[model samples]
Target chain A: MKLLRNLFVIIFLFAVFVPFGNAEEKRVRWKLAMTWGPTLHPFVDTVENMADMVETMSGGNFVIRIDASNIHKSPFGVFDMVKLGQYEMGHTASYYWKGKDMSFLPLTTMPFGMTTPEQYAWFYYGGGMELMQKAYEKNGMLSFPGGNTGNQMGGWFRKEINSLDDLKGLKMRIPGFAGQVLAKLGVTVTNIPPGELYTSLERGTIDALEWVGPGMDINMGFHKIAPYYYTGWHEPATELQFLVNKKAYDKLPEKYKEILKVAMKTAAYDMYIQNYHMSANAWSTMKEKYPNIKVKTFPDEVLNAMKTSYNELLSKYKKENALFKEIMESKEAYLKKARDWTYISDYLYLKSMSDTE
Target chain B: MKLLRNLFVIIFLFAVFVPFGNAEEKRVRWKLAMTWGPTLHPFVDTVENMADMVETMSGGNFVIRIDASNIHKSPFGVFDMVKLGQYEMGHTASYYWKGKDMSFLPLTTMPFGMTTPEQYAWFYYGGGMELMQKAYEKNGMLSFPGGNTGNQMGGWFRKEINSLDDLKGLKMRIPGFAGQVLAKLGVTVTNIPPGELYTSLERGTIDALEWVGPGMDINMGFHKIAPYYYTGWHEPATELQFLVNKKAYDKLPEKYKEILKVAMKTAAYDMYIQNYHMSANAWSTMKEKYPNIKVKTFPDEVLNAMKTSYNELLSKYKKENALFKEIMESKEAYLKKARDWTYISDYLYLKSMSDTE
Candidate 1:
C-alpha cells in the first residue's frame, strides 16, 4: 500500500510540472545578418535593443546572435541569407532588392512619398503590412519595419541647383529609382562605394551625392566638400526592414514569438526617435562649425520636372507589374487622405510657428 | 528495491523540474486604472493592447486587468489611486494633476511646444524621461509616455479672428493652460463637460470650443455648426501617460517587468499610429460631408498676443516651482535644436511638397 502511494505521488508530480516546465524553458537560438557594419548608429542599436528585449522578456531562454557585414562579408547578401535560412533573420532595406523583384522597391520609400508618421500609419493601419507580406511571401521570408531615417537629404551639392538646366550633365552619385529619374533629366548618375564617395566628390569625379540626412552625413565629412545641402525629395522616410525566415519564425514557441514581435516593433520606433535625436544634435553641431554651408531646395522648375519624371516612371511600373500597381494604388489613396490630415495638423502648426517667429 | 528505485526517480525529478517550473509558472495578477471611459479610443485601445501583450508575452502567467473611469468612478483620481497603490498602474495624462503639483503640467506638453516626432525624440532619447521620472518620484510612482495625439486643432470657431482685438471678450470653452493663456488675452474662457459642448456652441453659449483634432471631434459634429476650424497653437503633441506604483513595479519578477515595459512602449507607439490613421480617415469623411468647413490660422497679431500670454504664464510657473523651471529649461533647449532639425527635415519637405502642388 505504501509503495503504491509513493508511485502515485511521483506520477502526479511529473504529470503536473515536468512537461510544462520544459516547454516554458524551451531554448531558441537565432542568428541575424545585417546589411550594415557593426558600428552603424541607430541601425545596430535597433537590432541589439530588439535582441536584448527578447532575451530579457523570455528570461534568457531565447537568444539572437547578430552578425554585421564585417562577419557576414556580404552587405547586400542579407536578403538571400535570411530567405535561404543561412541566417534566421536579417536587417536590410527592401529597396536594395528591387532588382530581384520590382514589387520590392516601393516597400522602402519613393521619391516625394509620404513622410515618416504618415508612412508609419500606412504601414501599420492602412493595409500596408498585408501588401508588404505579399511582396516578401514569394521569397519565403517575413519582413518587418526595422527602423526609420525620418528623411534623406536630396544630397550634397557643390553649387545650388536653381533650374532644370543646372541638372543637365551634372555628375552625381544617386542610386535606385531616384537615380533613374535624374538620368531622365540628363544628370550623369553613377554609383560609387560609400568609402570613395568623399574623394570622388572632392576630386570633381562627382559634382554631388545623395547620402543619408545630416545625422549619417556629418560623420562622412560630405559637408566639407559640398557646401550646398538640398532638402529631401527622394527617399522621404526611408524605413529599413527586418527579414525573418518564415519556417524559422513559425517554429518559435508562441510566447517567444510574441516577445520577438513586440521587441521588434518597439526597437523600430525607438530607432526612429533615436535617429531624430541624433540628427538634431548632429545638425546643430554641423551648423555651428560650418555656418557657411548653405541649405537650398530645388527650384520649382527643377522640382516640377522631377515630379513629372517620377510620375512617368511610376506609370511604367504600374503597367509592368500587377503587385507593384496594387501597392502603389494603396499608397496613393492613403497618401491623399493622410497628407490632408498632416497639412491641417502638424504642417499648419509648424508653418504658423515659423511665421510667428 | 523497486520501491526505493521509484522513490529515487521521483526525488530526482522533483529536484530538477519542480522548482524551475513553479518559478516560470508563478501567477501574478494586477489591476490598472484609466482616466478614460471604456469607449475613448485610442486611449482605451492603448491600455487593452498593453494588457494583451503582457498576458501573451508572459505566457498567460501574468495578467493585468484594466478598469476604465466608468468602473473606477474617478477619472481625475487616477494619480492618487496609482500613487497610493490602489491600482498597480494607471493610464492618464500627466497634466491632469496640475492642481495637485505644478511640475506635472509640462510633462504632458506645452503651448507652442515640440510636435509629435520631436516630442517623442525628446522623451525617449533626450532628457524628458528622466525629468518625467523626477516629477513622479515624489509621488511614489513612475511615469512613461502612454501615447501621443500628434498635433491638436486649436478650436472650432463660428467667426474668424482678424486681430488681437477680435479675441477680446470672446467666449470660448478651452481648458487647461491654453485656457489660462486665452483668459489673460481678455477672452472669457469657460470649462464645460464634453457632452454639452456641441449644444453650448450651437446655443451661442460659447462662440468657440476646442476639442481634440478631427479624429476625436468628428463624432461631436462641431464642424457642422462651426465652419471655421483654427490651427493649433497650444498642446502640439499631447502625450498621454502611464503611471506605475513604485512598489508594485519593483515587486514584479524581472522577466515580467521587461515584458510590461516593452508592451507599454509598443502600445504607446501603436496608439499614436492608430490615431494618425483614425484622424486621417475621419478628416476625409468630415471634409466630404461638410465642404463648407474651412481651416484657418489665427492672424499674426492674435497669435503674437497668445504667445506673449503663454510666455508670461510659463514664467510665473517657473518662479513658483523649481522642478517646473528645470523641466521647462530642458524642453526649451531640446526644442531649440530639434525644431531646427524639424524645419530642415519634415517641415521643409512638407512645405516644398505643398508649394509645388
Candidate 2:
C-alpha cells in the first residue's frame, strides 16, 4: 500500500508539471526569406523586424531566417518560392501577379488610394482581409496586411516629364496595373528588379524606373543616374505581402499561426516607420549629392490624364473578373463614406487654420 | 568715368530687381493661450508655438498676443477656446488636455513616451499637423507639439501600499502622471486641478496624485500633496511643453525667435506630443461617472518588494540620463535624450514591427 501511494503521488506530480517540463520539446525552426537588404528599402527593414518578433514571441520556439534581398534568386520570385515550397515564407508585391488576376492590384495598392487607417479598417474589421485571403487561396498562399505605407511620393527619374509628349516611348521601368496604363499611353514600359536598376539606368538601358519612392530610390543610388523624380504610376497604394505556403501554414499548430499573425502585424507598421526615417534622410542627402537633381510635381494635366487612364484600366478588369469588380465597387463605396468624414475631420481643419487663425 | 558708368548700370539693375513695390505684402492674424490658467504656462505656449514662430519666421511684420488662461476663466480653457482659436492658437497637454487632445495623443503617449519623432518628427512629417491642427488645435488654436513628455507613470499616495493595499486610500483624481501605473497597482488616481487638490486631500477628498514626474512636481502639483510619492520616485520621466498663442502667433511677420525648432531636433525633443485617448476620457469621466477613487503606489517597503521597482524607478534612467548628462547636464538631462530617441528609433523599433515582406 505504501509503494502504491508513492507511485500515485508521482503520477499526479507528473501530470501537474507536464506542460512546463521541457524547453526543447516544442521549439520549431522557421526560415523567413526577406527581400529587404541590410539597410535600403523600408519594406526590407520591416521584414527583418518581423523575423525578430517571431523568435521572441514564440519564446525562441520559432526562428526565421531572412535572406535579405534576392540573394538566392530574385525578389519577384518570392511568390512562387513560397508556392512551390522552395521557401516557407517570403514577401512580394501582390500586384506583381496581376497577370494571375488583375483584381490583385486593388489588393496591393490603389492610385490616389485608400488612406492607411481606412485601409486598416477595411482589411481587418470591414471584411476586406477575408476577401483578400480568399483571393490568395487560389495561388496556394495566405496573406496579411504585412504593412501599410502611409503614402508615397511620385518617383525619381532621369528627365523632366512636362507633358503627355514626354511620356511617349519612354522606356520606363514600371510593374503591374499602372504599367499597363502607361503602356496604353505610348510609353514603352519595362519591368526590372531594383538590383539591376542601377546598371540599366547608367548604361541608358531604361529611361526611367518608378521604384517605391525617394527614400528607397535614393539608397538605390538612382539619384546619381536618374535625377528626374516623379510619383508612382504603377503601384500607388502599394502593399507588400508575406506569402506562406497554405500547405505548410496548415500543418502548424494554432499557436504558430498566432505568432505569425502578430509578427506580420508588427512588420506591417514597421515598414512605414522605417520609411519615415529613410525619406527624411534621403531628402536632405539627395540635394547635397547632385546639383542638377531636380524635384518637381507632375502637372495637373498629367494627374488628370492618369486618373482617366486608371478608370479605363479598372473598368476593363471589372467587366471580365467578377471578384475584382466586387472588391473595387465595395472599396469605392466604403471610401465614399470615410472620405466624407475626412472632409470635416482633415481637410476643413487645415482650411480653417489657413484662413481663420 | 567708365568705371562710374558701370557702377551706375549695376545700381540701375539693383533698383529694378529689388521691387519693394511689388514685394507682395502679406499679413496673418491669430490668438492663443495655455492651460495653466493665466500663468506663465499659458504665456509660454502662446508665445512660443504661435506668436513667437510667426514674428520670427515672418521677420516681425506680423504680431500676436495670447490672453492668459483663467483670464478667460477656462480650466479646460484650451479645449473650449482652441476651436475658436483654430485659426487662432491655444495650448494644452495632448493627454491632459485630451478631452480635445484625444486625436492628438499618438503625438504624445507615455506608454513608451513621446519621442522627439512623434513630438516633432511625426508632427511635421506624419501629417500630424493636418490631423492635429485641423481637428484639435483648430477648435480655436493652430497647434504645435510645444515640448516633450519623456516617459512617466503616476505620483504617490498616503497609505502603506502593498499590492492590493495600495488602493485603500480614497479620492484620487489626476491627469498626466501616475494615473496608469498606480492604477495598475490597483490605485485609482484621477485628475484633480492644482487648486482643488489641497482642499480635497486635506478634507479626506483623495489619497494621492501625480503631477509632472519629478522636475515639475515640487512646484506644480506634487509638492502641495507631499508626504508620499517620492521625488524621483513614482514617475522617472514625464515630458511637457506649450502650444502656440495663435492670435498672438499669426499676427507675426515670419521667421522670428522661438521658431518652435524641429520636434526631432535635440532641443525640441523637450516638447510634448500625446498619449492614449482613454486617459483624457478617464479624467473627464472618472468620479462624476465612476468611483470617488483612492489612488497610490506601494510603500517604500512594498515598492522595494516589488520585482521591477528599482529598474522601473531608476536603473534605466541611469543609462539614459548618463547619455543625457554627457549631452546636457541640467538634471533634466535624461528628458532631452529621452525625447531624442526613446520613442522613434529606440522604443518604437524595439517594440514595433515593420514589414509583411
Q: What is the DockQ of each candidate?
A: 0.65, 0.01
Flag regions of model 1 displaced more than 4 Å.
A2-21, B1-21
In lDDT terms, which candidate is top? 1
Question: Once all C-alphas are superposed, what RMSD does model 2 give against the true structure?
Answer: 27.8
For candidate 1, write residues A188-231 as lDDT tens digits.
99999989999999999999999888888989999998999999
Q: Cα miss at A24, model 1 (Å)?
A: 1.9
DockQ leader: 1
| lDDT, residue B330, candidate 2 | 22
The single-chain TM-score for chain B of candidate 2 is 0.53
In CAPRI terms, model 1 is classed as medium
The global Cα lDDT (0 to 1) of model 2 is 0.53
